[model samples]
Target: MSAAVERARAMIGVPFRLHGRSRAGLDCVGLAALALGREAPGDYGLRSGDVARAEGWLRAAGLRPVAQGRPGDLALARPGPLQLHLMIGTGAGFVHAHAGLGRVVEMPGVSPWPILGWWAVE
Candidate 1:
């Protein structure tokens, strides 16, 4: 597995918190940043409409948009009409901080939401 994937898996079960950035609590963006070893902005709302800002952060972190997600890649998904969620890709699943679950989790198989974009460190 990729080092990023390993890093993400290590955070399973962490409590979810809006705009949180640490192990104690994390949101999807925070989890993705921690797993990918990058810094993310905290000035965002629960229902963010600024996809360009998020994309900019990903790009600034040395990630490039890719055709599809593989292990260790980042996925931008829309779980709701106004919700933009981020997740780390595992070979067979994805690691994300699920607000509804109140913790981080690894969901197997295809994504449950519609994927908007995929980004890779390389």
Candidate 2:
């Protein structure tokens, strides 16, 4: 498996908390931040005040927008590698964040809906 995939897998079963960003508790964006931290130590620009602010923060962090998104792009779907939504790519099928499950998980098939957008960590 790729290092990114390995890192993501390591986070399985972590607890969920809104605006939380640690192994003890994490949200979708927090999980992405933690994953990005593994590759490099830098501020993920997460702010607790507003969730909408996250997109701008991520854009500032160097995530390039992808007009066409896919499941393989999940790890690179933001300025930081956050798996926030379901994506269909390769054989692993669909990838998405399951807040109830407290971690990102993959479904083995194409996504039922088209990807809205994507970004790659540069």
Best model per TM-score: 1
**Residue pairs whose backbone atoms clash in candidate 2:** none
Across 1-122, the per-residue lDDT of candidate 2 in tens digits comes to 44444555566677766666677876655666555442221444333333245456666656656766433344332322333332223336633445666666655665544444565556
Model 1 TM: 0.92
Per residue, candidate 1 scores C-alpha lDDT tens digits across 3-36 of: 9999999999999988889999998989998999
- Model 1, poorest ten-residue lDDT window? 41-50
Off by over 4 Å in 2: 38-54, 69-72, 75-91, 94-96, 112-114
In each prediction, how many residue pairs overlap at the backbone (N, C-alpha, C within less than 3 A)?
A: 0, 0
Residue 87 Cα positional deviation in candidate 1, in Å, after optimal superposition: 0.6
- Model 2 residue 106 CA deviation (Å) reads 3.0
Top-lDDT structure, candidate number: 1
Per-candidate local distance difference test:
0.88, 0.50
